[model samples]
Target chain A: MSADRLIKLELSKLNVHLPERRPSLREALSSARPQVVARDGSTHAFKREELEFLAGLLPEADRDKLQLPILIALEPKLGRGTARISGEAEVKVVSQVLEKEASAGELLIYRPEVAILRKKLPTTTQYLFLW
Target chain B: MAALAVSPTRMELLKLRQRVGLAQRGHDLLKEKMDALVIEFFEVLRRIQEARMKALEQLSVAHRALSMCFAIVGTLETKQASKETRRELQVEISTRHIMGIAVPAVEVREVERNALVRGYGLHMTSSVLDEASREFERALKLLIELAELEGSAFALARELEKTKRRVNALEYILIPRLKEALKFIMMRLDEMERENFSRLKRIKAMLEERG
Candidate 1:
């Protein structure tokens, strides 16, 4: 195959680990079983400890507003080593965990921060690739 | 006859060199990636071995406990208890990406410790069976986590092997062939230019002599 075609194929596979749709945090918390199917037709589960930690971070009312499997955006344009944590509750929880000051809406994190977040919430956090 | 030749030969040589450089860079980076993946894979494998051993041992212990309960509480009653017990345990699962590999998230539900929820009938209920089930449930959770980790480790290992092979091919074969071809072309171009220069000079000398 041509170099261009090979690179395109590699880039296409970058986000095959992500879920088609995410369940809301409330649904994950309430359901006895919570799971999401990946693009590659595999099932992925969330940890209860991470869910509880997220629940503790927000008010009871915000549980429904927040979503499970908080997306950690990995965009090549964000540079080779940076990722973003978006959404109000996600930002708030992540900033608190990393002991960084939380802004209102989104949090831009470096590679180290992303690694730390993944370590802390392995099952509840997923990496999403953005063009 | 006097028209200048563009000589795209030089341009092709430059482009070929650049490609060779890119291929070399890619090979080096991919080798580094494979090394990192191997390190990660072995670490997970070590953890999995430990987890599997512990989980299986715990399961055996639980089975022994249940056997004792059956002897003490009557086999019929014990079997009846297991049937009546609420086995509605659910796990919350999701996927996380590690270096482009998707690994399963296994969050096993905490088995209820409540005596009522334990669901063993009072007639021949032995605390031994409850304890056994609890232990087994805990082991099951740990085993599931280990399974997920092991599965991911295996997948990553396979991908690492494939990447390593590609890197090796580029470094040891494809890039080298391209460079060799480029060198051959360059040598031929230079020899042709030298011959042309000598021929032109000889023709000029002959023409001058004849005039």
Candidate 2:
């Protein structure tokens, strides 16, 4: 029982690095120092160049729709080496970066594609583990 | 693996099943963390390779320029000029978290300065000396960026190792032991139930014989 409790504790601590509130692209671009606070009270900063690149991908009206630190959801049930990218603005920007045809609001990408997306947009992208 | 010490009862079997479920969940989540860390590690490694090459090339170029200055402007005079120049350079260092690991984020302040701002007297230092200074300044900037990339790679690699260890422990040790204990309790309960059934049957036969 004690061992089981410890496992639960470890699971809880897994996502402490995630931000309390994710800022939109517009809000982050307008700020002098663009960053979001994590649940653990640490700050995660966005690079200015990455913000500009993301902004350039979308039009003026879509800036607010795109959120900072676009989450790539990783679920074990999805099978190994697969991840999902959700949100319309996020999918649009990611597809443009990867040179893939933009799908709907969600995109299921394989391992190689994930690597390309990460290499292209390191600061603006984050991995989110879903049980 | 040794099965856990517990009385073989239905209630204990229920608790063991729950424990096995929790262990499996933990193992899966931790394996996912390990996979994510591997990706992060390789990403950092890729950047570090590019940064290292750039920094090394710039450093060699700076060294060549310095050699030229020493040959043309006289070694003693070049040394004197270097001594007179202002060498105070500052870098802003901070932490950026990737997952839960804190990797270094370094921002170098303006390192390249013009001839006048270099603080060495204009007449004493020749154009060759200025060229050397400029090249060295560029090399310094590249080296700082390289350092930041290398630091992140190391941090990521360390975290990857740790997560891998935890995943292995769950997969190889904890889960197997729990399952073994669950199997033991289940088999014991079945045996006890059969014995009770036969004992009640014998008692019923004896009562019928007496009647």
- RMSD values, in order shown: 8.3, 2.2
| Candidate 1 lDDT, B1-211, residue by residue in tens | 1222224387777876776666655555455445445645765777788888988888888788878878887787778888888777777877666656766657777753665777666664567777767777777777787878888887888888788787777777766776776776688789989999999999999999999
Q: Is the docking of candidate 2 incorrect, acceptable, medium or high quality?
A: medium
Output the chain A TM-score of model 2. 0.95
lDDT per residue (tens digit) for residues B1-211 in model 2: 7668989989999988989888888888888788778878898888888988998999999999999999999899999999999878889999889997899999998889989899998787578899999999999999999899889988988888887887888899999999999889988999999999999999999999999
**CA-lDDT, candidates in order:** 0.73, 0.89
What's the lDDT for residue A78 in model 2? Answer: 90
In candidate 2, position B208 carries an lDDT of 96
Q: How does residue A27 of candidate 2 score in lDDT?
A: 98
Error of 2 at B166 (Å): 0.7
- Give the Cα-based TM-score of candidate 1 against the true structure: 0.61
- Screening candidate 2 with a backbone cut-off below 3 angstroms (N, C-alpha, C), the clashing residue pairs are none
lDDT of 2 by residue, A64-121 (tens): 9999789988877898778899999999999898888889999888888888888888
Determine the iRMS, in angstroms, of model 1.
5.7
